[model samples]
Target: MAEIRLAIVGLGKIAHDQHLPAVAATPGISVAAVASRNATLDGVPCFLTIEALLASGVEVDAVALCTPPMGRHRLAAAALRAGKHVLLEKPPGASVAEIAPLEALARDRGLTLFATWHSRFAPAVEPARALLAEAEIRSVRVNWKEDVRHWHPGQEWIWQPGGLGVFDPGINALSIVTRILPRPLFVTEAVLEFPGNRATPIAASLRLGDAAGLEVAVEFDWRQTGPQSWDIHVDTADGALVLSGGGRHLSRDGAILHDAPEREYTEIYHRFVALIGAGASEVDLAPLVHVADAFMLGERRVVAEFHW
Candidate 1:
């Protein structure tokens, strides 16, 4: 197929900061149209909604759904029914169940569906997987903390129901964990701290374990103040493997290993292109499942009301 004419739905910060740049850098794929409620881009047909964009007679072959997870399934289903391939942003849907029907729809239509976990494309991720494949896994630790003001700012949907709040970023860590590990991990227990004023938790701690007794400790906090921390440290029989700077840096036993420039979204689009070429779909719900499990098994505590 020729360069895929892609439409990006939702003009949030992530759309401009990540998807726009990634699509520009990747070959064999270019953004041809956009659907956003409150934003516009130069040289592209912009619509107020995805439905309007789809009906606008724009020559779009695929769409990247970057909207908040709450109602994305409707858009994905519409795109699939319209015979267009779809690329879903992280944490594909509001709930784990919303993805299966869309997956079936894509399969029925023979169109590609990608539930993207962009963090899995981090420079160190594949290499980390490769290394952990041969080593005896011991334990995993994740400390993903970032200030909402710095990252999300006034994004109110994030604090609303199904926005995933802290898990919005925490799911990225779960993505990397599910990718690198050799086996399935389940949430054993969790403690969630929800602000009295918000509908979601601002901080969370979770304990996870595999069938083989390997343990993983997770800490996700949107209330972090200083230099943000996005790190995962794993202890093996040989020592420890660390992925810091949000999987941009990798170190083994205090030795620098893979520290490549981060182009995670670029890699995502590259994989999306390949999937479309092959007429295949990539929808892995392991990360979202962990988040779901965390919520299901967590202890909720009401805290002070969060402002801004």
Candidate 2:
């Protein structure tokens, strides 16, 4: 197949830091244009909005949406209607209800719609999955804490209604968990700590379990000071497995099982290409469902106000 001429929407931090570089590195993919209100790429046609890019007729075969979840549905629907393949960043939409119709629309139009969970592509994720496939899981624990000041800086939208706050990073951990576990896990109880002035939570503690009563604990916090941590520990009948560095490192019983450089976005593009070739759409809402469940069953506690 010819190179996929892709247009990138919402050229913000993730787009500049990961998407653009990944697209450049992946074969059979080319950056045809870019659409963003305040950002643009050098050497590519830039537009203020997706509608403007579609109207300008830049001839794009696909579009990657890096926009916030609030307005993602509208943009994705319009792209599908326009007959272009679509790739959505994690946490596909603000609400779980919005995803089903988009999947149906893409299927009806025979266009590829990839709801990408980039962290699931971590090098150690599959290895961990394979290891757990044989071992009987007794319990699970997830600790995903990071400093918002260091990662998000002055990105104010994160504290807004649809920003997802700490969940913006928490969902990555959930994605990996959903992928590695043999059975589905559901949120049984949750506590979300919201800043007094913010619409979203700054920290959350969750209790989850599977059908067989297997226990799982998850903690997400944005108040870490010194060293940021993204780790998942799984205890099994055989031994304990640890996935540290946000799924980049996997160890068990004091021995390193898998550790390698991160190329998650690069692998994401590869999957997008394959999905487009197969004329299929991959949209798994399990991870997002877990988030929605947490919000529904969680108790809200107002914490001290935060300011950047």
Candidate 3:
């Protein structure tokens, strides 16, 4: 097998918990180096900044960026300009418009640029899409709520501008929704609840629709205390479809359809390998477009301040 030497940019929780392990388990790819401002991996060459790593002439063929969405464009563009394939974590960039130029850059350089939506790689997500594609969909409701304190403890960047706040997790639901449903979706109405002390929304209520007038009601909140809830319910003319456990579990009218362990990151890595080998780029911004639309059409309400 042809090997791809990959460097990791950013050593945060997601990189350690998901990207590292996935790359280790995947074939044809291995971690050659890492760049992080605060953390380092044992036995691996680490640099303070991406530019430093690229300048050091490290033998890296690909780069996975796990940093916060803000400032990622520069890092990714740097990697591509240095002749390396790039994989971006969810929400691709801080904004929808920024991703296209990166795509064009990769195309001009003949490098792979993958804007990955990991939730779409969930075990049941494709099955739901296959099922929904054949059924007559009637309605959709997305309840994506989670405790930000437990998930993002001490992550001060989450409240900053361009951090996406609650939509950080909520966009996962939108990714699956956009993939499974047959029709294109657009936001109709949105009510965003911003914390009195933060620059982003803590909770949001959104109404989305397609050309045929199919309505999708969405609720995103970062205030749940107990078990995190990541569920999507779709009411169709055939039967109701439920994708829960962040796309890990799926049921049709209460009968289990697809349930399995989550291998989303591993699958993402495999896709990355294939794309790099084929010299192709997979950059889909539909989910991020929905997020941008919500911000554009939503009404803002200042809620109580959040602590921790």
Q: How well is each residue in 138-169 modelled by candidate 2, as lDDT tens digits?
A: 99999999999999999998899888999999
Cα lDDT, all candidates: 0.94, 0.95, 0.95
* Candidate 1 per-residue C-alpha lDDT over 192-302 given as tens digits, one digit per residue, 9 for 90 to 100: 999999999999999999999999999999989989999999999988999999999999999999999999999999999999999999999999999999999999999
Backbone clash pairs for candidate 1 read none
TM-score of each: 0.99, 0.99, 0.99
Query: How much lDDT does candidate 3 score?
Result: 0.95
Q: What CA RMSD would you report for each candidate? A: 0.8, 0.7, 0.8
Candidate 2 runs further than 4 Å off = none
Off by over 4 Å in 3: none
Question: lDDT of candidate 1?
Answer: 0.94
| Decoy 3 TM-score against native | 0.99
